[model samples]
Target chain A: MRNLDEDTITQAVLARHTGAPDARLREIMTSLVQHLHAFARDVRLTEAEWFEGIRFLTEVGHMTDDKRQEFILLSDTLGLSMLVTALNNRKPPECTESTVFGPFHVEGSPEYPLGADVANGARGEPCYVRGRVLSRDGSPVPGAELQVWQADADGFYDVQYKGEHGHRARGTLHADAEGRFHFKSIRAEAYPIPHDGPVGRMLDALGRHPWRPAHLHFMITAPGFERLITHVFRNGDQYLDSDAVFGVRRSLIADWVVHPPGPTPDGGRSEQPFYTLDFDFVLNPLAQD
Target chain B: MRNLDEDTITQAVLARHTGAPDARLREIMTSLVQHLHAFARDVRLTEAEWFEGIRFLTEVGHMTDDKRQEFILLSDTLGLSMLVTALNNRKPPECTESTVFGPFHVEGSPEYPLGADVANGARGEPCYVRGRVLSRDGSPVPGAELQVWQADADGFYDVQYKGEHGHRARGTLHADAEGRFHFKSIRAEAYPIPHDGPVGRMLDALGRHPWRPAHLHFMITAPGFERLITHVFRNGDQYLDSDAVFGVRRSLIADWVVHPPGPTPDGGRSEQPFYTLDFDFVLNPLAQD
Candidate 1:
């Protein structure tokens, strides 16, 4: 057998998989094959180098656990997660921009009524997030379910604190009859992804920094319509362009403006520092049931 | 913002990635994106479902250890390692055929002199392996370093056993001035990869079998030449066509016919069969360097 270069084998592997008839799948596989091969060829990978790569991935696997996802972190740092997220979601103008799931969501959040505070009195810049669910033609789709979850002001998810449950700023709410939803919550702040794992080692090797922009996570679902898991990003965060996971998008960016509000005691909770965002969502409906 | 189905989000992720200009890279990425996206679509992935995938991968990470690489096993079983190995090494005919490094190589291996059996005292049918290292022009390549390794008759490596110094089946030896090298070793046995980890779970999920054909590992290097890391797969192993990792190349298969030493007491423990095969390795000098 003739010796094949790195690119040739990649091409062959990719070749056997083409013509899947699912045009979307075809396009994606093609890109993945190309980039992966190029990355290998760019370095002129040696046998040892190749094995080393395999070994690195093996280590990545070993670093994963129930509480942490080093592989997800790896995909995040590599921008693969973001790249896939973006390629799949293209909203019509003026919709809430999508972001990565960020590997923190736990199922069956407590459902709250409309206008309730999801932040549960946590301290941070106060902001009101208001949005409406609508069909692609801009028709309001009332009574849709919205699940909102986010890391706390300290950048640690509720799950990370171990036994600290009892509502760590996560909840679900239904869109009102008018298709509008609102909630009072603290503004999202920039955070660092977990770095004490093998993913961190990989980042060190690649010379990449780990910082994500401030953002809010939302999952909305309507009967006879597709569910959307997306985000509204605070535009001014320093790590917007290169969110450790590359999750930022122009349409998703929201204004984190200073909006002072009158407040009583409780350490002047909202008296001075405050932020407000007026964001909306656009959704495509499932074709007639 | 509105909820989008997993397919839509997957597409959106790809859209955000700017296209690569390199033609080869572009071709491959296009396919990779397609396959990855298809996998996502095939499962009708959900935010939670995708998270579980991340979790599965995290467990894969958690399974890695210094002595064992679960991800390499994952890649090997999924046919990625071999595919990548084949795509990169484009050697001309008559050179040694390259194959994957079975995930057992430690950074340091013992060194031995020429004609020494790497398989020292391992109990099995005796086999004699001889090879010549030559350049493409048929010139003998003296001082060629041949670092050879193979699994035991029971299909477990010495490292896996943790007590043996490994049979003379593995060592680094320098070729003689005439380009000749010889070693004695027990015949290899087809082995099953580790099936207790996440990779094993993946194989179960994919409904694929796991079994690698018997083979001896070799790494041949000569100054100013392309190095070769390859395997000589046993010709009649049932797993040859379906080498769990897809590492079988028809050209690399070798027949080890039984040799009769006229009523030997060793095989005279004679229920065991034996064979001798004289294999040759020819490496090409790097054309540029």
Candidate 2:
């Protein structure tokens, strides 16, 4: 308790947490403190730098609210969110790999029947998206619920529009008995994550861009399978190799084929050039606990 | 860039920072990311736990404002502040050891002459504090400025009273020709740091107490000596061995001798019981470039 120098203070801190009733909590706090102490010691962090970190975190926190989650942005941009996703959602190679569940996701999105135009007046070239949900054994996952959302061509999600936009380019739908699902939406485009906050300043200082590759967000849930939250990135996007959040996975990329102004997947004629994408999701079964 | 598993994402993240212009910033960020990723992998951190951390940080940020800083409290309780203080203030064995510069310190305190009662309407047993500032070689450092502050009997700093109290138990003064400084204030008592925020919740979860030992804060500065920010802890305090901030050092402890109703240090009579404390500080000379 006395004379806690830099080397011994870590042990003293860990000793204080010996009484935590929750084993998991104790383990977590122990690892956190050890690594945190090691980090401070490794960097030989100075008082001024430490104060600057505190100020940066405070600014990040203040930037968070119901509409914006700057802390999650911090995590995503730092690749921590992807790392956590990778750790928590380890799946067989055959099953779909999960990625960052970005901060723009909203609950209670309107549900429509299969093949509905989920774009809802959002601007961009019309795109028809179709996918099938299957189990790891390659069987149909009938009636699986699919929650889809994406930023419009202008690179802004409906939530980022500040009440000027409705639930555009985001909706919930269900797969058919054959596990086939389709929806009409705008073409995805590479866009920067919500910058202009503390995280943005950090990225700018680091000389890193905040743009993520063009992608569509998906969250699929079935009765007996693990929930899958991932993105289907456009195959040839420029930022695909450098997705800002590190959310890109090889298995998740799909080609967005462009067609002449002709019949669309929805059996509707499009006067303007339209794009279509087809991909399949394989869900892993719930762990046998 | 693609197929980034848990093991590879760390390097990918670090590689992105290769272009940082400031070398120090880049180094700090590199260590931070490495330790952060290692901690996550060590704990096999789950998405739920990650969300909890984000939420906790957000709450801590929201609780902070111009009047209070919850993030600093978070760092202090975790012993990071103490570690940083120890790292930045590595003095010779004989020089006074530094401790956490708590958040309650305010600039522009009223200046008072030597031996003045700085406890302006604060409630506590009257105590006389006297000390001499000396160089590490034991020579007096005359005209050293001493900034002193302490919480009242109720464990509340003047600023914690929510504007109801002006300046109480805090003032700035200069040492005299012999480097001797004296002030009249209240006897220090063990008190809890401001809890009831997210940091408090974390302490409760860890089964740790938030109390710190009784001590008087002093920031001493002389012309050729390094700035000394430290505390003279009251001997025999119950929380001495379990300071919530891990700020206790054997050399910083001093005894507060109690006296019956009698003459005070300033040649005045005290009807109530009074306490007197005598301590000396040794400052290290500033390092040469």
Best by TM-score: 2
DockQ of 1: 0.21
Each model's iRMS? 8.1, 0.6
DockQ of each candidate, alpha-carbon based? 0.21, 0.90
Q: Please provide, for model 2 over B1-289, each residue's C-alpha lDDT reduced to its tens digit, 9 standing for 90 to 100.
A: 9889999999999999999989999999999999999999999999999999999999999999998899999999989999999999987899989999999899999999998999999999999999899997889999999999998999989999865677999999999989999999999989999888889889999999999999999999999899999999999999999999999999999999999998887999999899999999999999898
- Model 1 agreement with the true structure over B120-177: per-residue lDDT tens digits: 7665678777778888888899989888777788877777787656444577888999
> Chain B TM-score of all predictions, in order?
0.83, 0.99
TM-score of each: 0.74, 0.99
- A-chain TM-score in candidate 2? 0.98
Local accuracy of candidate 1 as per-residue lDDT tens digits, A1-289: 1233443455554554444555544554455445555544554444565676666666676666677677788777655575456555655555555667778877898899977778885657667777788877778989999998877789876778867656767899999988999887787988889887777765554445667788888888888876688778887788776566767667678786675566622234564666667777887665573
Best candidate according to lDDT: 2
lDDT of 2 by residue, A14-79 (tens): 999999999999999999999999999999999999999999999998999998999999999888
